[model samples]
Target chain A: MNRFIARNGPAYAFLLPWFLGFFLLALGPILASLYLSFTRYDMVAEPRWVGFDNYVYMFTRDRRFWKALNVTFTYVALAVPARLIMALVVAMLLDKGLRTIGVYRAIFYLPSLLGSSIAIAILWRQLFAADGVVNRVLADFGIPSHAWITDPNTSIYTLVLLAMWQFGSPMLIFLAGLRSIPRDLYEAAEIDGTPKWRQFLRITLPLLAPVIFFNLVLQTIEAFKTFSSAFIISNGSGAPADSLLFYTVYLFNEAFKFFRMGYASALAWVLLIIIAVFTGIAFLTSKYWVHYENERD
Target chain B: MVEMTRRKLLGTAAAGVAASALVGVPALAATRIRHYWWGNPERDKRTFAVIDLFQKANPGIEVSGETIGWGDYWTKMATQTAGRNMADLVQMDYRYLFEYVRRGALKPLDEYIGKSLMIQDFDKGPIDGGRVDGKLYALNIGANSQVMVYNTRVFQEAGVDADLINWTWDDFAKACEKISAKSGGKVKGADDLALMIEVFESWVRQNGREFYDANGKVAATVDDVATFWQFWADLRKKDVVRSKDKTVILDVPIAESGIAVGDTAMSQFWSNQLVGIQAVSKDKIGAAMVPHKAGGKPGQYIKPSMFMSLSRDVKDPASAIAYMNAWVNDPAITKVLGLERGIPVSQKIRDQLAPGLSEVEKLSINYFTAIQNKVGGLPLPAPKGAGEVRDAFMRTGSDVVLARTSVKDAAASFIDDAQAIIDRAQ
Candidate 1:
């Protein structure tokens, strides 16, 4: 015991604070919520055990649950690609080796830094409002204006647009990945009289596949967990025909507003499984396309 | 010095933490209690002033006030309730009173009445509004009812001088149509009131029925709600009310609504909200009774705007109850907090605050006074999971206005969905 303590004591001490936080704050609640998923806990009263009832109802009868799933899935499908493409395009633009690259990177990165904040979400709501700045700008070109944020058919698209606008994080990653690619390969392609588009298709696309896969999986999970902007824009009730009812937003309402903590726990677990499945699919499919420089041919 | 071992070091740190926590608890023998409330900036200011007054009056008691916006209040309270660390004095709403009381989160105030809590002069109606299951769990701080607050300038410009007091639904619709036509579509006649469950309840009560039956089921049929949505849908088609896109921003403060922004001439809200609306609006605002059905009952009822209750885990019930008593019955506190929460329920406080009210407050008071005797009895408290039901109603109503679904289908789905929410909550 003395020898063990002497060998690992300092390292364990260094990790004690995080260990305390994990055990007391994170792990305890995580396990408790897992147990709560099988019960009916309203926060105020005792949790009543009703095994699988919350899950059964969530799967079979909850219309809002289905609606939330539909909205979140649609958002993930649209937002993930839209954001990645925007990020890659911007990263390519910034990769031109300009003298003011640092300044431009900072400027482009500002939106993502501010993206998930309540102030930015509120600003997005105002920007897409009926008589807001977006409409005013559209009016200057004689384009008829529409309420982009509140219209049921168009509201989720506004959130997607917000996601595309805040492509700073992935853009930085892509910029790093682009910088690491060998310039000699591109020069050799140029020497062969390869067209710019074909070079992009053959070399740049294949080389960036690993980075793209990484960003795709990360952004897809982030898209599925979207809450703050959707909650703010939809007034926290998933308004305008439940078009903005993201899964996390619906889970929040079920837990906090309605106090159905147990049901919300079940919903949360289902969301976790959905994200895991998508990530798994992405990983399994990536083997065919993604290549690493260190990997054997 | 002894060489420090891991166990000894951990024991010393634990002892240090325990000592610090113990030192933090007692502050010169003065009783410390927390008072929590949810309101806007104006109400927060008024509430803090009252808290200061209470602290000043009782030097032995130290009161700290915790204020949050309305949206976050319930969530915070639920979390605190779960942790069993709720504030000593909790500001509650009528919709949540039954839920909190049923869950054993509130202390029954009946034992403190006429002792530490003074309410001998209070009226029975407001008092009863705070009772759940025959026990007084909270004290009503203010009483208010629904009313139509209009921009007088827009009304005059549109030449809409219909008898707002005795007007029927048809009269309101005609006036709205005229307002839109006269404005040449520059301004909508009204913000959408169709999604307001309070207005729907009023309509139900006007037809000589309560919104909820004795068994806690919704008494209004799907057809009744369908008709209500159809009325608003026709108005949407005529462009009298704001469109679904403009009207669905329900989370914004009342001061940001269309009527306050001059995009609409009128809006339906509680009487107490008139001061807030008028404060932000440029036009001269006036209040009137909500338009009832022709030859039907007057459905408006004075509602307890909010309540102050002692949490079950209160550390100092005497201090907490005293603060609640002062909140309602004290003239000094009422003078500063006049009509900010709602109209004060105490007769003496109302008499004291009458001359000191601002012009907008006077307008609210006048409308409230005129409609006091004419209103019907208070409706039953909302069922559990009413917050979800209200959201479902608004979603269905918005669907009808957006023309995403027929009114009949939306109403049917809303009824089925809301009932299921209520049943699940049970």
Candidate 2:
């Protein structure tokens, strides 16, 4: 036992720094945030316990909270499905082995790399502006194009499109998943005279379910925490009648802009609970669809 | 085995020595004073020059200056102040002056005013506006007042005089209609709906009702705000002015304004923005006092463009005050800064620098000087919910324009939202 301990001592010591960082930097802030959820910390003064007040205000009173939730859900509902389908389709096309596969992959992945940055958000703002490139093209086509970002009705959809255009990460994941699916299965299906659509449904989709689940969870989490794009694009007001006021944006305003740190912390906890519930449901529902090749039924 | 043991000992000793040296070094080697301000490129260059001048003059003081876009300045300041890591000296806006002061973030400057700096010649109003509840928390750097800046060529093409001193709202609308017709819709009259509350507050004050009560509560009714909206709404209906897509340049600066870029004939902006407005327009740009209501008192006020305040938690209050004194009161520093800080509040500095002003600066000075007789009381310290109120104003105004709500409903909703925000803060 002593020998075992001695042999592993240096290995454990090597891991100590990372463990300390994880606990102090990551875990510590989360725990602090949990405590702050029950307080009325305005960032200027020390936190004062306000028990359920922030939660109560969020659920029952804060109209902006509801508005933000609606905007976020609308974005996710549209963006997630659209992004997934587009990614899968593009991945399938790329998998067909085009001549300039590397160039195509790079082009497809470029938006994902750039989309989340402030510069791209600024570019997005300019592209949708009244006299901007998009509008000028529309004008060339003899179609009257008003300010897309300035109009309330169409602004959120523009954000959804921006989110959709950055489907490269999910596409790459889907592409890898598709490649991992055995070519023998498709060959066998073809011998049995199975249709291409049926092969895709029976083999490709069922096998790709796990990858889809992974992508969905990750993208949903990222979508919920979205701030920079909305912040920079809307110029921080979520303008045109708060059309782009997402959950994180509202939380930011509460915490920083209004100095309601406790309220924001509560908001953070609620978001965690929401994500937990959603992820739990996704796992629970996966049983009906996801297939494991090695597991016994 | 002996050789391995000696090597291990040497490595351990070397690591120990490195660790000790690293720990022995101070985290902050110098007494660093963080200074934050917002301005244009010209202002930024001038401010940096002043900082260089300060660093040269006072070798002991290490000052770091961060400049951000004006739109983001307050948001960043609010976050930093709330985080309790605010810069030593903050360039403060009048709209947010009371909010920060009431939160106990700003140090009272009364003690340091005469001892650390001299400002006896400056107007009492501008200086006193920086004080809340008799505690001087800020020092006015410069003053700005609202003015109507119009393009001379656009007005000439429309056959309308650009001087708008005696103009009423009706006259303004007529000019806009005429300009639009004459310019073949290339030049509209004004920017998006002039903020309703700003105009409404002024209107209410002119009609003998203060926008805010003595206790700093909103005094105007929903009907008052609705009437203000109706005037602009009518202008929109007549096609004299543009709506959301055409007029309102959301979340951008006055320099990037469509009106200032010659897409429109006139705009309501701060007098100090004349330089920026002129930079965009090839045509001659001129300024006049904002038109008052017919037979009503002028509701214009001399407002502080921005103030410099010391943090309450600052380790060296006297030094911070000294830095502010040098930035604001020093003749050489003021010359370098020019009217980029807005028109200098220090009468001595203003007199010294007035003669050698640029055309834009001269226009700004003349605009302020002409309205010197008609200027109303100084703007009050904004209340706690001022940020929320400003947001509500923008949101509710958009709602009204979209026809999602009546002007009356929008006004009432704004007041309710604003009141709720204040109540929550309290």
Candidate 3:
């Protein structure tokens, strides 16, 4: 035992702080929230065990629960593809062209860094308000300005535009992927007199599948967890007829605003499951399309 | 060598114990008090200034002050309460007073009343506003009521007089129409308040009823609310008030709202917010009673803006009470404070600050005192889950304006759903 301890002592000491925090700070609250999910716990009082009551109420009676789920799913479905495709297109544009693309890349990459911050969210609200810059620009074009952010039908679309605006990180990753593609294959296709579009369809698409899959999984999860932008935009009440009621926003309101911590815990677990199922599906489907360059096909 | 080392170790042990005892006992003797609140920069400035004065007055005590912005305050406060580490003094909202008191996070100040509180000159109405379950748990910092705030410059541009004291709903609508036509579409007449709690309370009160009934159900009849909704909707149709896109940002806060930006000439808000809005626009803003029915019991209730209470974790009640005494009853501090919080609760301080008030402060004091007898009792303390119900009001109101739901149906459904939410609290 002494010999084993001596061998592993340095590693153990290195991990000691993180191990302590994990168990004490993280694991403790995780288990506590799990227990509370089965109880009727308000912040004000002791949690009374009412096993599965919160889940039951959520599945059976809560219309807003259903609405929140619908909004989140719609957001994920819209934001993920739009953002990734935008990244890929811009990456392609810079991969073969633009001598000073580094400057442009840095400029483009700035939005993703600030995308989820409260300040950016607030700025987005002002930019899309009725008298804001977007409408003013539209008015100059003689297209007639509309209430883009306030209209329930178009509010979610404005959020999608915000997500799409932050395509920088993904574009960087895509550029790296593009650069790594062997030039010999493209040269051989060119020698064979293949059309540019044909070469792109046959080779580039297949080669870039793995990166696309990676981005799809990552962005989908990130989209599901969106909170700050919607919260700031809607003033935390999911107003304009609850059109901005993202699942996380609703969960936050339940936990903090209404102090129904138990119900919020239940909602949180449901979000975890939803994200897991989508991620699992992406991984399961990757075998069909995502191929590594190292494969000996 | 062994004998010398053992003697030295024993000597150090004795000294350490003595030092610890000396250090710990004085902690008990220090009379240190911790206070916490959430407010703007000016409020923090005035509060610290008063603390400086108090510290100078009593050199024996040490006080610590902490401030947080309003957006994050409640979350931090709840965490502190749950941890049983709340500050000795708490700045609480009237909407949240019952919640804190019910949770036993607040200390009942009845025993210290008239002694530490020095409420001898305090009015009964605002004081009674802080009681829960027949126990005086806290004291209000001041009183306020809902009123219409207007920009006097805009009123002149629209060729309208500044007085709206005895105006009816119809009169308000006509003014909006006239102001809209006169401005040549530059400024809206007034911002919509359809989604606000103050507006709902005032409207129901004007109809000779209250917003919440005896059973704590929403008492504003469906027809009454529908009529008001229809009024705002018709105004929207006429472009008198804001249209759909602009209405989306309706009456957010005084500083950020359309009124501050000169898009609207007037807005309905609590009298407590007078200083904030006036400071925002740097324009001459006027306060008038919310337009009532032409002839009925005036339905403007003077209510407490906020209450200050003792936390359950207080170390020294006397020191905390001393701070509270100076906060409410001291004339020098209240005069410095002016109407930042609201009308001063103490009669002596109110009379003292009266002559020294600016034109804006005088507007609030005169309007509140004028409407003192006209309004009904403060609506029943909103029940638990009241936050959810209040949010529902906004959602339903928006649905009506967006024409997603008929006004009558929306009103009926909202009333039923709101009542059900309140019932769920039981």
Candidate 4:
């Protein structure tokens, strides 16, 4: 132990700052929020412990809590798969040695690069507004315009479209994963007279499992936590009847808008648990599908 | 994205250096006060001008101002208060005053009244409005009556003479329909009524009841709320006002609002917003009182535009009070502020500035002043959970217009929701 410490002391010294930051900056607030979820706080005043009141109220009383959960889950269900499929499709296209593929990748990557920003959210709002360019373009094609973001029935779909539009980062990851797949495997399959579709299903699908899993978990979490675009499109009030009321937006309104800090803390904890559960489900389910090259299982 | 992170890191490093540099300066050598407020650009310009005047008048006192948009201001204020980094002075709203005072976030100004505030000729009506629990916690900046601001062009185009001063709900409906028909569907009459809290409050008042009681309960009956929704829904059906979808589309900014764009004839607005709304167009916009039910009490009553109060953690209450005095009572500030904050609450300032007032300012002042004797008593002070109630009101309004629920059911559910929220807060 002494000899190992002596050898790794310099490495440990270099990592000390990050370790300290992880404990102090990241973990501290997380634990504090957990404690706060059990309390009644208005931010301006002292937090009071109310045992399980916040949890009980959330489960049995708060209608908005249920609505937010429903909206968030629906969004994750629709957006994650749609975005991942689009990413995989585009990555496959770019995997072939097409000229200007780099430029095309960069251009495709631009939307996700700018996706989470408030400016892009504002631009998205403008494009999807009732009289916006989307409607104007539709009119040119003799298709009547629909209130895309304004109508309650269609607002969440616009956000799903936005989520799908930002498939760039995952696409890039998929492209990298695709490149790492050995060419011999596909060539051998083709030599056996396997059809291209069958080879893709058997070879590409199995080889890309780790990358696909990563993209799925990352995007599902992101879709659950989406705030700015929905918040902006809904004018920060979650209106045209709360259709754009994403979970994070609802939590924000509860904490900041209504000063229900304790309730918001509980909402945050619930969101953390929900994401953990979904991620857990993904991992438990992945063993049957995801194949690692050296895994004995 | 790569550029954003690099710039952010640089910004943090620069801020660290600047903060460390600031550590050397003594903070209390001179009385330094930080004031925070939410306002539009015009009001910001006017307030800054007044601050400059005050600074010139008192060189020993150093004052800095910070501002945010109205929507985000309260969130920032609550976060600051929680962090104990509250500004020495804050501009407050009537809806939020009770909540802040109840939470001990505001400083009581009763002790400083005679010493710091020179209110010799100040009107009691405006002063009394700022008191909470019979103790002065804030000072009124200005008071404005609710008004119906109309674009003259739209009204003319519709060939509708909306005499808003003596108009009733029925009259408003007929005029809207006329305007919609006359314009050949190029414009709707109004989509404004459904979302306005004050408008609903005033409707209940005209029916001889306040929308919210002194306890901040939902004072209006289901019938009262139902009637309000039914009125707008009927108007929607007749195409007198915009449909729910159209309403949401025009909900961007006043610049793009139906009235400002000459798509609607009129909207209910506070008198102080007259200039900002009129600034978007050269259409000779006009102002008149809000309509009420026939043979009912007047729907127009003055509301304090905002209040200026001392923070509970003020470093120098005396300096803060002195600055507040200069802001409210000094005649010179009247020239700089004009009617940007609504009519000046100080009688001396109002009389002093009346002669030099611009046409727009004069119109806001004259409209409210003319309706002085007609307006009902002041609406009850908003209670602790007022913000949530207001939101519920808005949500309920949307629910009604979208036919997600019937008007009566929405009203009943809103009452239940508001009561539960208020009770839970208690």
- C-alpha DockQ for predicted model 3: 0.46
Q: What is the lDDT of residue B418 in candidate 1?
A: 77
Once model 2 is optimally superposed onto the true structure by TM-score, how far is the C-alpha of residue B340 displaced, in angstroms? 1.6
Q: DockQ each candidate and list the results.
A: 0.73, 0.55, 0.46, 0.61
Please report, as a residue range, the 10-residue window in candidate 4 chain A with the lowest summed lDDT: A237-246
* lDDT per residue (tens digit) for residues A138-213 in model 4: 9999999988887889989988998999999999999999999999998999899999999999999999999999
Chain B TM-score, candidates in order: 0.93, 0.90, 0.89, 0.91
**lDDT accuracy of residue B43 in candidate 3:** 80
Error of 4 at A13 (Å): 9.1
- Clashes found in each candidate (C-alpha, N, C closer than 3 A): 0, 0, 0, 0
**DockQ comparison, 2 vs 4, better candidate:** 4
Q: Across residues B1-426, which tens digit of lDDT does each residue of candidate 1 receive?
A: 365687799899999999999998874548888999998888888888988898889898888999999999999999999999999989999999888988999989999889878887888889889988898998888888898888898899889878877778898898889889999988888888888888998888888888788888878888778888888888888889876776676656787788887888888888878878888899899887888888988788999998998898899888777888877777888888888778877788888888877899888888887887778988788888788788888877877777778899998988888788788778
Per-residue alpha-carbon lDDT of model 3 for A117-195, expressed as tens digits? 9999999999988778999999999988878778899899889999999999899999988888888999999999999
Candidate ranking under DockQ, highest first, comes to: 1, 4, 2, 3
lDDT of 2 by residue, B1-426 (tens): 999999999999999999989987775434668788987787788888998898788877777899998766877876787667888898888887877777788888777657777877788878887888887788888888887778778888789863477677768878889988997776787765545456566767677667667676877677767777887788777766765574433545766665656677777777777887788778888886667778887787888888998886676666677788898777788899888667887788888998889988898888888888886787566577767776777778888776678877887887777777766777
Q: lDDT tens string, model 2, A171-250?
A: 99998998888899989999999999998888898899889988988888778778899887777877778898888888
**Of the pair 2 and 3, which is ahead by DockQ?**
2
The docking category that best describes candidate 4 is: medium
